[model samples]
Target: MLSVNSVLVPAEANVEVTFTSNMLVVYIDRHSKQVCLLPLDEKRQRKPKPYPFKVIAGLVEAEAVIKAQLDIPTYHLLEDSSFTTSRIVKRNERYQIISPIISEIHRYMFPRYGRSIVAQVAQKTGMQPTAIVRLMNMWFYGGQTINALLGDYSQVGITSPGKNARKVGAKRKNSPFVGRAITEQDIAKIRRFLNKYVLTRKIEEQMTLQGAYDEMLDLEYSTLLVAANGRKKVVAWSDDDIPSYSQFYYHARKYFDEQKKYPRQFQVTAAAYQKDHAGRTATIERINRPGELFQIDETPFDVVLVANRFSITGLCVGSPTLYLVYDVHSNLVVGIHLTLNPPSWEGMRQALLNAFLPKVSFVSGME
Candidate 1:
């Protein structure tokens, strides 16, 4: 399956390439079978061009290795730098501009990035051919994601304090209140609230980010008000006085990064880890023989059984527990034990005996 962002590297020393579209598969035709691809080269190319599907598929089947398959999450997760709102918006705008060009190219069976295609796309999108070509090249090389179009802000210098009086970044849109610069006091409060609420080894005690933010507001940014009716009420501070969720999230991410902890923790019990993770083998690749591994489990049967002699009286008996030992490699149930007794070592021992003993003698004794 060659899909968009699937990287193909040749066995020999050659420039690798990535598929830009799955048009050949979706719109397959006997007369024309080609896919759009871009070469992964240091020097930027003009645009993605079409390659014969038969030729590329043959190469992939024989000698080429699919190096990587990149999706939106994989691309963003692998990025070391964090994305700001402005950067995200800019990337989205660039994607919007190039999406039409991409769609136009995909419409044809075997489209070429020639002057004709470029001119058509330019006329339809009201953009210059050169600009479209540049963005297309950027999108292709950037793992075919909107985030790839984001500008590198790492080298950009921070704005001077003289630019704004109260706030450090852009002002809030469609709002009377403006966000203020984060102060040392605010950072201390954020740390305190996070420690008290967010980060915890106990899953049941963990609080969500929104809950932590709300707690901070109630404790730090709110004041008790006494009305004329003699009733006391808690009044939250103005938006300008309190930090926004984005600010809190940003600081929290920085704190986690400094502590070398993942933003989202996977909490698992010791028993669960031992069962699901510890000494686990890759069954698909490692298990090659029938007796190499056995999966054993005990489960109660769904239906209740009745005593054989008490059927006329309609006497009800409890459901029996069933223990099964499954052979993984051969996908067969090698051993089973059904008992009315509660699950115990006795049932397990009987099941193991049945598995090791000859089947003919066991069946003969049962009959």
Candidate 2:
């Protein structure tokens, strides 16, 4: 005996098969006119019954008519041999295992009859009910073929990881608010509003969080509220499409930390940034070599100088101006000029001359 577990057929097509005690079961496709012979089982056969010559002749004639319609040739039949018999036995064994499943499925489609069908199939076939259900579902969805029920394996024939993992809402799409209260779009709007109003605007006018919240609420309601005078009152703000301040602030803070915190802190607290953050004082300069530059300035000496020597007592004198030139790179005194007269442009000219003159020749004494 031979039976079919499942077979792939076209839509609205039927399968025809004729069988008896010891003959092979041949399947004919009603639409395609193709014939498939099922392997026979000697163990399942009763005491060797005589061949049904009439049935065989009718099948042969049907096959010939199908071939004539398709314009294909027919081949000669071979005598029975041990090899053919063994192949039949193996195929029959597999068929017997899968026959009951096919019968149950044919009796009740899986969608119409689910667990009950699986339970009945399990009871009749002695197979795991879930396995039967899974196979049936695969068959219904995957071309209704026995091959669709087979498991995938690696090249080495090992079952792949998670191949048969339980499917618990696995095909569902992810929600934007999976771990949060608000969606990403709402959070983005809050951040953009915060940046435009809170951080980037005038620092002096920036309000605290509570003040901002109150302002937002006022702005929200003000647009909808009409004045009693009804003088064509107009308000530019509306909260009709806006979210709550709490939700807005939560995501606003997140975007703020990522975009604004560090830069804003630097700008707000940069009073002594050059000396503190930059690690350099205002008076310091980086010089590499000596005698690169010079500095010149004039100032009155603290001590008074003698102006007249003709008097018995030295006349009290005013302080004389002293001009000094120093090298900025080496910190050395490059030139000096002294005179009793108050400072003038000529005094500066002489100071410049003194800087270029020989040190030994350019001598000066206090008067």
The parts of candidate 1 lying over 4 Å away from their true place are 13-31, 64-67, 70-82, 107-114, 120-128, 152-367
Clashes of each: 0, 0
lDDT of 2 at 235: 61
User: Clashing residue pairs in candidate 2, if any?
Assistant: none
Superposition TM-score, candidate 2 onto the true structure: 0.26
Best by TM-score, which number?
Answer: 1
Candidate 2 yields a Cα-based lDDT of: 0.49
Give the least accurate 10-residue stretch of model 2, judged by summed lDDT.
67-76
Tell me each candidate's TM-score.
Answer: 0.32, 0.26
In the order shown, the candidates' Cα RMSDs to the true structure are 25.0, 29.2
Give the C-alpha lDDT of model 1. Answer: 0.70
Cα lDDT listed for each candidate:
0.70, 0.49
List where candidate 2 sits over 4 angstroms from the true fold.
Answer: 1-290, 313-317, 343-346, 364-367
lDDT measured at residue 162 in model 1 versus the true structure, 0 to 100: 27
Model 1, residue pairs in steric clash: none
